[model samples]
Target: MKKGTLYLIAILWAVIVILPFLWALRISLIPTYTTFVSFFPKSLSELSLVNYEYLLFKTKFPRWMINSVLVSGGATFLNVLACSMLGYVLARKRLPGSNVIFTLVLALLMVPYHILVIALYLGLSKVKLTNTLFGVILPLSANPFGVFLMRQYITMIPREYEEAALVDGCSRIGALFKIVLPQALPAVGILTVTMFMETWNNFILPLVMLTKDSMKTVTVGIADLAFQTLNTNWGVLMAGSLLGAVPTVLVFVLFNRYFLRGLTLHGGLK
Candidate 1:
């Protein structure tokens, strides 16, 4: 395709991807009654902060936001720490049954998480972990995709770096922190952003694990807002959704450089 054609396609795709958020933003700014009346506001005068105000002050939205942050942030940190160590081991250690372990990890990537929900609920129930943030965080803390990503990226890095560190009397764990992890920043950024977004936006896991109103994450809380009343409050629901989406957006923006660099290197763009 021509360069101009490619640019046009890219622009169109961007618009397509952004339209829903734009609509949500539009709806969020207007009165709930006016939501279905038109796509575009008749005038700027129609816009108001009432929805945002109500969502913030008059509901459990703030508590839910805190819950989401705690759960998603905890899950992301654990995934990075666990996956990094496991990936390094699988890539460099050559431990017994390591190949079999990796194959099982690969198989896990093909298994849909939905199927595990029942088992997860049962096991957590047995441990009396249900209805707690830890329960939600624990299930999402380590991802097979994260393990696979880290292992593949770590393999591409030269062993000479860690070997030099080891010769300098650095412990194996020290070398991982001082040598391997620094070089794996791009992959770590990718893992951080992806895991945070996945956990932040997760609905099913939190919904099942947490039955208390105060323990609900932003996703489940917004869902409650949508169905809590006989008539749905579009304005408040959209407002909650927009706010709920902000963290993921900020996380992506903060780590986008690493994400782009990782993609470029992995894709041979340079």
Candidate 2:
């Protein structure tokens, strides 16, 4: 293709990718009738902040947003810590049954979470974790995929690093905290963003676990607004949805380099 043609194709691709989101932004700023109207507004003469104001003021959006932030943040933190440590074991120490344990961890990647939901509910009920924030956060934090990803990254590192640290009088914990953890920064950053978004976007788990409105995340809160908001308040709901997606997108944009680095390096090695 000609260079002009290639440029044209790229521009068209960009437009196609961005069109839906732009339409959504327009709809969010427009009135709710636009939801069913099948067309953009006739009166571009005036735009209103009515929906934004309603979404922000009249709803429990702030509380739900805070709830999502806490759960996702906490879960991502826990996941990074746990996954990195477990990954160190899977990568370095080759004990008996270690392969089986690692294989089982990888096997969990194939297990549909929905299949485990009922069992998790029963287990949590035994521990009185039902209808709580911890209920929402716990299931998302124990990330097998993060462990796998980190293990791949760790296996690429030279064994000399760990051994040298050990020779310098560092215990396993100290070596991990001082050496391996620093080396796993790229994987940690990727896991942080991915796990945070997973927990933030997850509604089914929270819906199953939390019966109370006060513990809802943004996803569950949006569903509530969709059903209970008299149907015409979709503009308000869209505004909330747009706002809810911002943090995840922002974090990804900022930390995307780390995600790319980890995956690329891991893939290059094995």
Per-candidate TM equals 0.88, 0.87
Scored against the true structure, residue 252 in model 1 reaches a CA lDDT of 71
lDDT of each: 0.89, 0.81
Off by over 4 Å in 2: 1-9, 31-45, 259-270
Using lDDT as the measure, the top candidate is 1
99-212: candidate 2 lDDT, tens digit per residue? 998898878877768789999999998899987888767878878888888888899888798799899888998988888888877677777777777788787888888778
How does model 2 fare in lDDT? 0.81
Worst 10 residues of 2 by lDDT: 261-270
